[model samples]
Structures are given as C-alpha cells and as structure tokens.
Target: MPAFDLPRRLVAEALGTCLLVATVVGSGVMADTLTDDTALALLGNTLATGAILVVLITVFGPMSGAHFNPAVSLVFALKRDLPRRDLGFYVAAQIAGGIAGTMAAHLMFDLPVIEVSLKARTGGSQWFSEWVATFGLVGVILAGLRFDGKAIPWLVGLYITAAYWFTASTSFANPAVALARSLTNTFSGIRPLDLPGFVIAELLGALCALALMGWLLRQPANNTYSAARHS
Candidate 1:
C-alpha cells in the first residue's frame, strides 16, 4: 500500500530524522531562553517535540515508516519487518541527519555549529531512566501496530511527552538523538562522555521490548512464529 523504493525510503528517513532533531534542539534552546524555570522549559520542549513527532510520522510514515529513531528501526529489524541489510544504512542516515538537525538548530539560534555538551548526564539513575524510556517507546510502537496502526504517531508523541517529565534523563531514548544532543551544549544536551551508558541502556531496552512484545502478541493457539508467518 505504502509504495516506495529503498532510495525514497532512505531519503525520507534522513529528512524526517533531521527535522525531528531540529524540532527537539530548537525547542529546547527557545524554551530555555524564554523561561528560567526548568519545569517550564522542559514543558515547552516536550510539547514541541511531541507535536513535531506527530506531524513527521503522519507525513512520512508511508514514505519510510517514519523511523526517525535508530532504536525504533532496530526493533523493527529484530521483528523482521525491516531487512537486515538495510539496518546499517538506516542507522547511518539517522546519525547523519541528527547532526545536520543540530547544525540547523544552532544556525537558527545564532550559536556555534558544533559545541560539545558540557552538561553531564550519567550514573545509575540516568542509565535506568533511559532504559525505561526506550522500553516504553518500543512497546507502544509494537502495540500500536497490532491495535491501531493509524494512531501510532499520536501514541508515540504522547508517550515521549510523558516520558520527558517522568524520566530523569528527559528521555533521550534514541541513540541518534543522544549523540546529536552531545553536540549541543544547551538545555537538552548531554555530555559526549556519557553516551555509551545511555546508548547501551537504550539498545537493551529495545531488545527487551522486542522479546516481550513477541510473547505478549503471541497467538492463542500457536506461538509468535505463527503470527509472523501469517502477517
């Protein structure tokens, strides 16, 4: 139904990721400038990021499945919806797009194109928060596919909105996002040195979601294999 070649799909992925990160970093910078209250700044960032996600996903879902996050793409690849051969390319595109998005945001804010984040976000609590955030995100995505494919954009948007407040790390659940944020020394930025912990936690969370969803969505009479085979 959503017909598009790999080239088109790749382009869509890159473009969507770029816009998504731009929305994130740009909103954070603006919010911080407008308000001294941390909560208020986060609130603005959350709303803008969630709003942009809904728009981007709705617009690009047909074009490339709208996988702006590498973690999401990894989940789909594990589920076999995405080809193994394309996974590396997808991740590469997402990372590149993320950097480009950060640059765009910087340009808009009249800041340096690439400033390494000095804001330190690390430790057990932060790592655990990332795990939970990414886990919930992937879970929502998988569940949406089964129950309401049309509402996935809204579902993801809402989830991230909540996660931003609830999680200690402000839910930088996507590897590309975390990496790009490291390049921005702003309200939403994270230290580059802390990337490994967050990324590892995110990957673990995504894998856990895949395994759990596989079981949760298993056929009544048969295993998940039957459901996948039929789908």
Candidate 2:
C-alpha cells in the first residue's frame, strides 16, 4: 500500500498529468509559432515533453507512481501493483487533468479554451506505430522496475525521447494525453475522429507488454532453480 491516501494519490496523478500535458501542448504551440520548419518544431516539442516527464515522474512517483497514462495504470492494476478498484479513479483523474492541461495551454497562448482538432492522424501505419510505441513504453517501465528501480524516471524519459523520433505517431503512447491533444487544434493536436484507432492500439500494446514482461521477469521456483544449478 502507498503511504499516501487515495485522495492525495489522485491529486498527484491529476497534477502531474496536468503539468505534463501543458508542457506538451505549450511547447508545441511555441515551437510552431517560432519556426516554419516542421521538423524543428517537432524537435522542440519532443525535448520539452521528455524533459518534463523526467521531472514529473521524479517528483510524483512516490505519491502515485506518476502514472499519467491510462494504459500504464491499467498495466499496474493487472500486475496487482495498484488496487483494481482504484483503476477507474486513476484513469478518470488522468483524463480530466489532461484536458485541463490542454485548456491551460490554450489560455497561455491566447487561443480558445476548447477547440476540436482537425489534424488528420488516422491510418493503418500510424495505428501500428501507436501500438509499437506503447508496447515499448510499458516494457521499459516494467524492466526498469525489475532492475534499477531508481532509474525509472530517466529510463522512461529517455525512452520517450527516442520514441518521439522513431515512431510515426510521435509516441503519444499515452491515451489520456492523446485524448487531451484532440481538444487543441494546435501543433500537438490529433483529430478527434482519429482517436479511436490510437486508443485501441495503445491499450492492446500495453496489455501485450504486460503479458510478455510478466513472463520474462518471473523468478524460477526455489527447487527448480536449485536443481538446475546443481545439474
């Protein structure tokens, strides 16, 4: 059980997610405004998002495990690391916080508070990319927990940094963030219509990672290991 109460944990999750989404959207808007070069803008956005993930996870991990993504929360619940009953609440808090972050970013940039994105992000290739991105993210988290738990923040941050460049979808491995991004018709936005494919792909990816990592990280029984060692 966590040292923090449910309310406190929920607050941490919401606040962390809020700040994360704000950084993602704000940096993208700022970068787009400053440059006509699409790649440069994406690079700026990626750096800000990755840097903020490290900070947020470092600060909030102790409180709520810093799960700003529903896919991640679901994985923990499946692994029995998080209470199954709290899964819904955690996901709700994350999604609400993410939307608030989008609004906060819009306010900072003098844009409308709520706008439906028309950015076309649909396609089979992009859906597959989302699956790959989320699979890698969950795998990284699970492996980091297994070895070098203290380095989880850095591991996740660096993984996302690389994923942003390698994945076609810019590694929106987070379903909450993807949903929030749909509310902003800005540089970081994805079309609301395109969300279903991404969300399904991400969820499937996380589940697959959980299954694979569970088997890979399991320890052998004492007798089995002893016999194997002796033989």
Candidate 3:
C-alpha cells in the first residue's frame, strides 16, 4: 500500500465533490427556468460539467488523485496506483461528500424533489445509446489518465464538449456524479428507481475504457506512474 497525505486528500476530495454537485445541479435548475426545451437544460448541464471537470482536475489532481469518479478510482486500484484497502476510504469519502454537496445545493436553490438527479436514462436513447455514451466518457477519461497530466483538464473538457454534442445520452458515465445530480430535482434528474440500469451501463463503459486504454497506451501498463502534474 502506498502512503498518502491524508489531510490533503480529504480536503481535495471534499472540495471537488462539492463543486461537481454545484455545477451539475445548479446549471440544471437554472436552465430549466431559462428555457422550456429540455435540450437547453442538457446543454447547460453539459457545459457546466465540462468546465467543472477541467477546473477540478487542475485544482485537486495533486492532492487527491482528482478521481471524482468511483469507477476511475477502482480502475486505478486495479492498475496498482491505489491500494485495495484504501478503496473503501476513498469511495466512502467521495459518496459522502457528493451527497453532502448535493444537499447543500438543494438548500441553496430550494430545489424541488423531482428535478434533482444526473443519472443516465432513456429519453430518446435506447440501452445501447446509453452504453455508447458512457463508453465515450470512459474513453475520454482513459485517454486523459494515460497521457500527460498537464493536458488532462483540457482533454477532458474537449471530450465532454464532444460527448455532449455527439451522444444521444449526454454522457453521464459516473455513479457518484449521478447520485449528486439526482439530489437537486432539476433538469439533470433521473428517476431514483432507474439507478441500477444506469450503474450497469456505467460500469460497462468503464470496462471499455480500461480495455481501450490497454490497447491504446500499450506500454507494460502496470503500476506505471509517470510524473502527474499538480497544477
């Protein structure tokens, strides 16, 4: 197991989680009020999400690995960058922080119950569309992770921008993010009952990301930590 700067990691995770919820839920709620079209709401959520990912990665990558996604954290553990036992700690902190962040957003906005989630689901998308959108998201994250950390925020931003415009599902690939978004009852919400299906699709997308990274990065791919950029 690798040693971590625990205080730094926790603080970074807390800030990142808060911002993620704020961006998603805030934008979603605002967009719904600004426009009657659902497309406008999605556009707002997507743009806010992309911008936040870039900002969060730049700010928090040094302190806590900047893995706002549980799937990413788990995959990094599989790749030996993270300790197996520590997975529990990281995930617990992330989920708790995410929920807290969402709740705070709810308090701030006085959100309604129905409009508060970022979970993946069908509107016009079929299951395969959901799968492809998530795969695209994972694909972007894998590419970002396997490459220069300095480029991560921008690359991720570009990926998010692309995913939003290209995919039918609007690319909600993360469960924690979904859960936080779900808390706001805004344009980003998905029904609570539909969570399981979204989770399965996200995991599948993350698996695809791992495989794609394996083929794409193609270097011994084990415990390989190049110098990660902090800022």
- Across 2-45, the per-residue lDDT of candidate 2 in tens digits comes to 69999999999999999999999999999999999999999999
C-alpha lDDT values of all predictions: 0.93, 0.96, 0.71
**Pairs clashing within candidate 1:** none
Residue 53, candidate 1: C-alpha displacement in angstroms: 0.6
User: Which tens-of-lDDT digit does each residue in 1-231 have in candidate 1?
Assistant: 258888888888889999999999999999999999998999999999999999999999988899888999998887789887889988998899999999999999999999999999999999999999999999999999999999999999999999999999999889999999999999989999999999999999999998999899865766666987899
Q: What order do you get sorting by lDDT, best first?
A: 2, 1, 3
Worst 10 residues of 3 by lDDT: 222-231
Q: How would you encode candidate 3's per-residue C-alpha lDDT over 1-231 as one tens digit per residue?
A: 224576668667767877787777777778888889987778877888889888998888877888777777777777778777767777777777777777766767776533544554654364455567667766776676667658888887778767776766566666777666656556667766666676677777777777877788777534444433332
The alpha-carbon lDDT assigned to residue 231 of candidate 2 equals 100
Models 1 onward score TM values of: 0.94, 0.97, 0.82
Clash number for every model? 0, 0, 12
Q: In model 1, what is the error at residue 24, expressed in angstroms?
A: 0.8
Pairwise TM-score winner, candidates 1 and 2: 2
Candidate 1: stretches off by over 4 Å: 222-231
Candidate 1 global CA lDDT score: 0.93
Off by over 4 Å in 2: none
